[model samples]
Target: MTLPFFVYGTLRPGEPNHDAFLRGRTRTERPARLTDAVLYDGPGYPYAVPEPGGVVHGDLITALPDAYAELLHALDALEEYVPGDPRSLYERIAREVIREPDETPVRAWVYLAAPSIATALRTGGTRIQTGDWHSRNR
Candidate 1:
């Protein structure tokens, strides 16, 4: 089954990873938002967490193969993309992504960054930008 990846960073369209994975690839991108979220500064990446009323903007991409999944995973070096890794951040799971008026809700495997990752790379600062990976260290 193709998987859904919850991407809040540069993996979005027109970004660096977009070309590698989404370039010329036919997939559904949904406008989904996460609430009470804070983006954290990881060693070389970013992670999200639920806050009181903080909302996060992201998308849910569907119909991706294992290879494509790996390609999408290459974007984050902070977590292990292996079949089983304790230090892994995002997990491949199915979730309901918010769909726009003209959008449709499709089932997909989403990669959720682990909370421990948030604690590990918690630098206390993350900014929201369209298609740019935010890192306090950067």
Candidate 2:
């Protein structure tokens, strides 16, 4: 299934990687939020770690049909997500994200911290308390 992508960190609009990767590849982008996830500060990005009651603010991006496969591949490479690789930093998963204003639910691909990374983040990583990477204090 070709679902939209829920981007919470550098991949979101106006962020560093947006133009570099998603600028011409997306057909639509809008405000959205992922439930059960929180953001942790990475060196130059943010990691979304699943947690009960957590809410992550981001964008729901729909890729143009022709760009889907390429976009997916690029994102996987950029995120260092090797399927079934224990050392991968992120894991891409499909989840429901709530669109803003209407509060409608839409299934989208979300990059979450991998198991080990999540474990470390849960124990000692600094969280981006606001759940919005752009709002994090520098």
Candidate 3:
């Protein structure tokens, strides 16, 4: 199956590392909206989760080379996310994302950060935005 990746952070093809992921490999990139979630500024990035009446707004881009699923999992987990490590902060989950007006729901993966560590969240003075990272130092 072609892995569909839901990009709500730096992977959205404009911020950092955009050239590495989106350059010359994107099949169909479109603005996507996922319901039942919200974006919160985590330690190094943003995270999303299902919240009543909440929605996660981002882009749904088809990544090529096929192995993007594994690659993305590694990249997202490269830092704070660890294999079988409860200490890890981020997690990858396959979720349903609405891509278009008439297109059927598609399966895509998104990295969700643990919200238990709200202390690490930048809740004041630093607002979070979709697909854009304004962090000075992660």
**lDDT string, candidate 3, 11-56, tens digits:** 7666665566566666777777676666776554566755556667
| TM-scores for candidates 1 onward, in order | 0.61, 0.98, 0.70
TM-score of 2: 0.98
Stretches of candidate 1 off by over 4 Å are 1-3, 64-79, 101-107, 121-138
Per-residue lDDT of 5-39 in model 1, one digit per residue for the tens?
56665566655666665655535666665554556
**Candidate 3 similarity to native, TM-score:** 0.70
Give the 10-residue window scoring lowest on summed lDDT in candidate 2.
Answer: 7-16
How accurate locally, in lDDT, is each candidate?
0.54, 0.95, 0.63
Q: What's the ranking of the predictions by lDDT, best on top?
A: 2, 3, 1
**Candidate 3 wrong stretches, greater than 4 Å:** 66-70, 101-103, 118-138
Comparison by TM-score, 1 against 2, better one: 2
